[model samples]
Target: MPRKGIALVISAPSGAGKTTLVQRLLREFPQFGYSISCTTRQPRQGEVDGKDYVFLSREEFEQRRAQGYFAEWAEVHGNLYGTPLAPVKDSLQRGQDVLFDIDVQGAAQLKLSLAEAVFIFILPPSMTELERRLRSRALDDEATIERRMANARQEMLESRWYDALVINDDLDTAYDALRSVFVAASLAPFRSPDLPEALLDS
Candidate 1:
């Protein structure tokens, strides 16, 4: 029988290398399921519905939230974003580990709801490096960059609560550390819920 899968919830600041690490993890572990969140925000350019996000109207989002459909939900800059509980549960039942790429706020909410999940926080090498990386993107204005920097500081402060912290100074080193974390979590006794019973039966 297939073993129960895990929820690997990872959070990082905007400028951190969270996305890159997640992409590498998925590429390395193709069996892992990527968690697609639901959002009330309008689709951005080139963002496909259901793939990028399960776009919902305010009314539809509220209705589902009222019915406890979301595993975790949070509002950011006036837009609602949530992870649907049903899909995650289905993924777990099928023995496919689910990966969650979420912000610190959503990560906090997820901890409360999904206490069994393995939470990891990614951090930049330093504030200076983080600022440099953010500016390198040229995706945000000065004001937005400053705001994100402030947010990053706050998020790092909260990272203390996570199960693991990976300082993304070197891409290969960070990825190795992250992979180690996942490997350890996967091997944890609790994760193999069926092992003891199976061995006892034999």
Candidate 2:
């Protein structure tokens, strides 16, 4: 029997290595596909439409919002970001899981709409370590880094809402844990009822 596709949401503060872990998971697990989000923010260097993000003007974004196009949408730092409903529904209908790398707000919204969504919160070892990792990147100024740290605290507090928590102290170990989660979710009786029959045949 074909089951609904699972919506796997991954949330983490900047520099928590969540992005790297998700990339690795996609590479390792071909059964899952990343959901490209639409955003009103201007694309950074090297970001391409439909690949990095579905870049849109504020007017376009607002139009879609009015039309009820988003499953979940939020404004962060004055930029609008939203997950399109069509692709996600289509993927699930086809039995392909969709991975969403979104912020806490979006994750919460998604959970309300997709009751079966699997939420995963990623965290650094410690706040001190998180700061070190953010600064080491040298991408943001001190003020920006400080803001991110503050946001990280808030995000951490909300981690309890997630279905799973991954401490990215070691990338390989964290990846393994995430893989195990996907494997288990896929094999769950509710997700795949055919498992019992297959096991019996084997």
Candidate 3:
């Protein structure tokens, strides 16, 4: 039997280091492909279209949403972001694992759509650490930071829905734990079936 592809959803609070963990996991595991999200938010200074995000106009994003093109979408801070279903479906059909760095709502949507998806929640060691990381970014002012922290608390409340949780206190250790989840998921009975007869004959 052919090796089935897996979708891994990584969720976390704003400063939980989820993005950094996803980057390292992809770099170390070539078999996994990153799923680029489409968003209506303006691109930041160093962010590239299609790389950081598929930056789309508000009209375009709404049109796609109307067409049901996204597996999941949400509006935050007056900006919309969504995970396009096409690329993810294509990658899985091509026998490549797809990694989604999405929020709790998106992850829940994915679970409903793809029952085989591996949901992993990356978390900070403590709320204090989470706040420190958020402040270190220096992108938001006090009001925005406070809003984000509140959102983070909500995100934490949703962590129990995930298949696994990795506390990202140490980057290397967290990466290892995340990688192990991927490895185990790949080897699971559902994803990897018995060897084909044709191959066994050789």
Candidate 4:
């Protein structure tokens, strides 16, 4: 029988290489079920609905939120983003790990509900490198870049709360570090049903 799956949460500030690492992990790890989130933002070029995000309008997002649809939800960068409870619970029930790409605020909320989830924080090597990388993307204006840098710094302060920290100085090296954590988590004894609860209660 397949074992109970774990919740894997990866969080990083914008432009800190969180997306790249998560994308690579999902591509390589077939067992992980992607937790596609619902977002109130307009779709960026090439983004697909129900795949990249659920793509809800603010009204629709709020409507669902009110109906008790979200397991955890938060507003980030002035946009509401939520992960529906149904999909995540379904994956876990099927013995497939659920992967979450979320912000620190959402991470905090998730901890209250899923205390055993594995949390990893991705960080840029330095503020200088992070600024350089953000600018290189050419996706936003200088003012927007500055705001992101500030946000990145704020998020970095919360890295202590995570189980592991991976610095994205070199992509391959960082990816390897990240994969190592997954390997270790997969081996955790808690996943084994043979370990009786009486052992813990004693």
Tell me the TM-score of model 2.
Answer: 0.84
The reply for model 3, stretches above 4 Å from the true place, is 39-67, 77-79, 194-202
Q: TM-score of every model? A: 0.89, 0.84, 0.80, 0.80
Global CA lDDT computed for model 3:
0.87
Better of 3 and 4 by lDDT: 3
Q: Looking at model 4, how many pairs of residues clash?
A: 0
Q: Where does the lowest 10-residue lDDT sum fall in candidate 3?
A: 189-198
Write candidate 1's Cα lDDT for 1-202 as tens digits.
4677889999999989898999999889888887888999999999999899999999999999999999999988999988998888888877889988888888887888778789999999999999999999999999999999999999999889899999999999999999999888888777677887898878
The alpha-carbon lDDT assigned to residue 26 of candidate 2 equals 84
When summed lDDT is taken over every stretch of 10 residues in candidate 4, the lowest stretch is: 190-199
Which stretch of 10 consecutive residues in model 2 shows the poorest summed lDDT?
A: 186-195
Q: Pick the candidate with the highest TM-score.
A: 1
Report the C-alpha displacement of residue 155, candidate 2, in angstroms.
Answer: 0.3
Give the per-residue lDDT digits (tens) of candidate 3, residues 1-202.
5677889888988888887888788788877777888999999999999899999999999999999898889998899988888888888877888888778888998887777899999889999988898899998999989998999899889889799999999999999999999889877765555555557888
- Among the numbered candidates, top lDDT falls to 1
- Give the backbone clash total of model 1: 0
lDDT of 2 at 146: 97
Ranking by TM-score: 1, 2, 3, 4
Candidate order, lDDT descending: 1, 2, 3, 4
